[model samples]
Target: MAYFVTPEELVTSNGVDVRELGTGEQWYEAQPD
Candidate 1:
């Protein structure tokens, strides 16, 4: 399965202004960005 979200939602939700996040075994953000 996969997860999806709109750019506006990402920015509004957590202030993430990125377009895409690619595949990876693990990902982490030490603190909110």
Candidate 2:
């Protein structure tokens, strides 16, 4: 599994702006079991 920090500004998978996260916040994608 891998994770990355979100940029200063980002767009969600659903194409929505997520400005709540702080810079360098860890972001992850959901994985199937």
Candidate 3:
């Protein structure tokens, strides 16, 4: 199933300065403050 996220959740989960990886697949990189 496809996953959906809200803007608030994304910001909260990943913070405001999050990066994404796409090596063979897509994923979010959690950056520490």
On lDDT, the leading prediction is: 2
Q: Using TM-score as the measure, which candidate wins?
A: 2
Candidate 3 residue pairs that clash: none
Tens-place lDDT per residue, model 1, 1-33, is 233345344332454333444422222232234
**Which of 1 and 3 is ahead in TM-score?**
3
Off by over 4 Å in 2: 1-5, 20-33
Selected candidate, larger lDDT, 2 vs 3 = 2
Query: What lDDT would candidate 2 get against the real structure?
Result: 0.44
Query: Per-prediction count of colliding residue pairs?
Result: 0, 0, 0
lDDT of each: 0.34, 0.44, 0.32
RMSD of 3: 9.2
Off by over 4 Å in 1: 11-33
RMSD of each: 8.7, 5.9, 9.2
Instruction: Summing lDDT over every window of 10 consecutive residues in candidate 1, give the lowest-scoring window.
Output: 23-32
The global Cα lDDT (0 to 1) of model 3 is 0.32
The TM-score of candidate 1 is 0.21
User: How many residue-pair clashes does candidate 1 contain?
Assistant: 0
